[model samples]
Target: MKKLLIVSLGIIVFILLSLPWVLILVGRNKLHDYDIPQREQLIPSSDSKKKVLALFPHPDDEVTVAGTLMRLKEDGHEVVLVCLTRGEKGKSSGIQDEQELARLRTSEMEESARLIGVDQLIISDYPDSGIEDLGMDSLKKVVLNLILEKQPDILISYDSNVGLYGHPDHRLTGKAIEKVFLKEKGKEGFSPDRLFQVTLCKKQVEVALKLSSGFQRNYPENPEMGLPQPDFSVRTQPYFDRILQVMQAHQTQQNVLKDLMPFHDKVPAWIYSRIFDREYFREVK
Candidate 1:
């Protein structure tokens, strides 16, 4: 009985130690699993150039779709990035003063937007982490004015359903964008060809929650909530290296990036591309 117990414990330890490696090996070869037909080009083929505008509550929020934006630039379309806040409330390694931190983050966002080939980068002073407090009408009006000024052919923002992970700021940003889009779309001088909301596959969300305890703790109810399903995915494999550069641009947010995407720097580019080759989005109808 004693020997049997020792063997059982040994087996359990071995399995626990081997699980991650086994998963990695399997993931490296399973790229075909993600090769769905619905994974299509983000920009439709056209002779006329189009302007793409993306809005997010924070500076680093653009990281999720940076590759897609790069792709837009590569395809000869204009890309505009509007960050509603400078991420003044974000975590900083050494900066203690909120104003100084905001400045640093804004600089970082400028570098990131430059790397993504954004033609116009707009940073607003709306309080970070306090977007919802501004009220929906005010938010809608601000978004509407931006849309009117940019006259972008495509509009992008966070999903209205789960806001990618139930963050209140993210949710409010999406809500504000959707409200404006619904109310003013197709109107003269305010028409957008498409409205796409950034989202994650259910499986991607599950993996995120499982990998990062911070994500789980912050969004404890996320698993129980329904997220907007991805209508299509943008193939970003070609821009994977540029995406890494974009992430690296946010030096102050390295800790947050490491927490969320732990394997980004550990694996080779090819391997990382295999896993994160596509950015998912839901076209708001």
Candidate 2:
């Protein structure tokens, strides 16, 4: 009986030790199930370095594309990030005051941008969770003015359709960028070569909703409503370690991040990167 018990205990320990690797392998296979495009075919080719600008509504919203941004920096492209709100309304364990939370979140974003090697980090004081109140014309004007000042070769933002789970601020940010794109399109010197909207595959949305109640609540009621189909995907495996560091920089938003990526802090970076090796984007026509 003693020998049998020892064997059983050893078996359990072996399983426990092997579980993380098992999960990582499963995740890698599942990701491969998606019909992702070839990177060479989809990524634009340019002889000279280009400027890339990303606009998002809240501080931690940048996390969605952190890896891709880092890859862009490594490719010798100039990357700028514009955050429209400080994410003060976001829930944090110890932070109770909105003003104090705003400051903390702003600093967190600054750290994140630094880690991502962004050339410029622009934080605007638009109301948290109240971007729609700014009105369509007002928001469009703001986005247009930024584009004119930056003259970025590529523009990035959330998908206007479902906002990657129907966050109002996220949707509005995308809308504003779309409006500017429409206004300046075909104008010789004013238009960007492409506008890429960050999006998740249908499988990703399903997985996120299962993992995070926050995502479930923010998602649209209509069953058909979701992000547009991805036009391309960026392979972010090379920058995955830096991506985790960027995420960690947003300390104030750890609760939400943990909910979305439960094993983020627990798993080895190599394992984590295998699971989240790519980010999808839709090109706005």
Candidate 3:
């Protein structure tokens, strides 16, 4: 009787100790996947030719952030695109092989650029699906060089952490961008301080969470691990449409997308109106 009681007590204690972790795990699982259900309002900008540079970790990131860029270009910003990786590991519909997929995505980006009126497209041969592996020193070297060469009035990239379980490439690029900026800011000279990036806001986080919950219902990959929610957002409708078009360009990830987003017909207009836009640096005068 004593041993049984002792064992039961031990088990109860252990369960009690793990209660917090279990609750956290369950809460996170509820938001395993999601998509942006809305669009942000485009803030007004000067109609002059403002220089802008966008650094993205993969082909689709550029497309993902497409709507806001569209607004910037429409506002007369001179836009430049820098793709950090070829996203060779990414899939495409109709295209069966890796080589073809890469080619198709590149072409798709070209189409995206044409639609958005981006003035320049630059790509680094960093391994596809391998941006998270970028070495700090190497990234710093490359980013610094690009900063000098582009001389952009504004620099944009992934926020420190994307609200959803972030893509490794996106997180790495975000960290690398901050490192590069910190290393270059106000130093002897690397042109003027025209660096900025788009960020996810709190309202956006709420939306992303709701969307992710829906996604989890379809594909229960890993129980979700919730991160910081968004607090800032930008709106770009036309760009959001373009982003959808770009996503459509990638057919293989249909399963992933299916899990992460709502059917187009079911998505609400208010969600569209409140879409999360890119977060970036403030334009230096």
Best candidate, lDDT-wise?
A: 2
Model 2 segments beyond 4 Å from truth?
A: 1-22, 31-33, 38-46
lDDT values of the candidates? Answer: 0.82, 0.84, 0.59
Residue-level lDDT tens digits of model 1 in 1-285: 999999999999999888766765676344333443445468776647888899999988899898888878888898889999988788657777899999999999999998888999999999998988899889898899999888899999997766777778888889889988887778889868689998877667667777876567565474556567777788888888888988999998888787656678988776677567788888988
TM-score of each: 0.86, 0.88, 0.67
Residue 203 displacement in candidate 1 (angstroms): 1.1
Write one digit per residue (lDDT tens) for candidate 2, span 196-231.
Answer: 998877777777778877788888766677788887
Model 3 ranges with Cα > 4 A deviation = 1-48, 92-96, 162-164, 192-194, 206-231, 238-240, 251-261, 265-285
Pitting candidate 1 against candidate 2, the one with the higher TM-score is 2
Q: C-alpha displacement of 278 in model 2, angstroms? A: 0.9
Candidate 2 residue-wise lDDT at 129: 91
Please state every model's RMSD to the true fold in angstroms.
Answer: 6.9, 3.6, 14.1
Point out the worst 10-residue segment of candidate 3 by lDDT.
Answer: 276-285
Comparison by lDDT, 2 against 3, better one? 2
Give candidate 1's error at residue 221 in angstroms: 2.7
Q: Compute the lDDT of residue 84 as modeled in candidate 2.
A: 93
**Candidate 3 overall Cα lDDT vs. reference?**
0.59
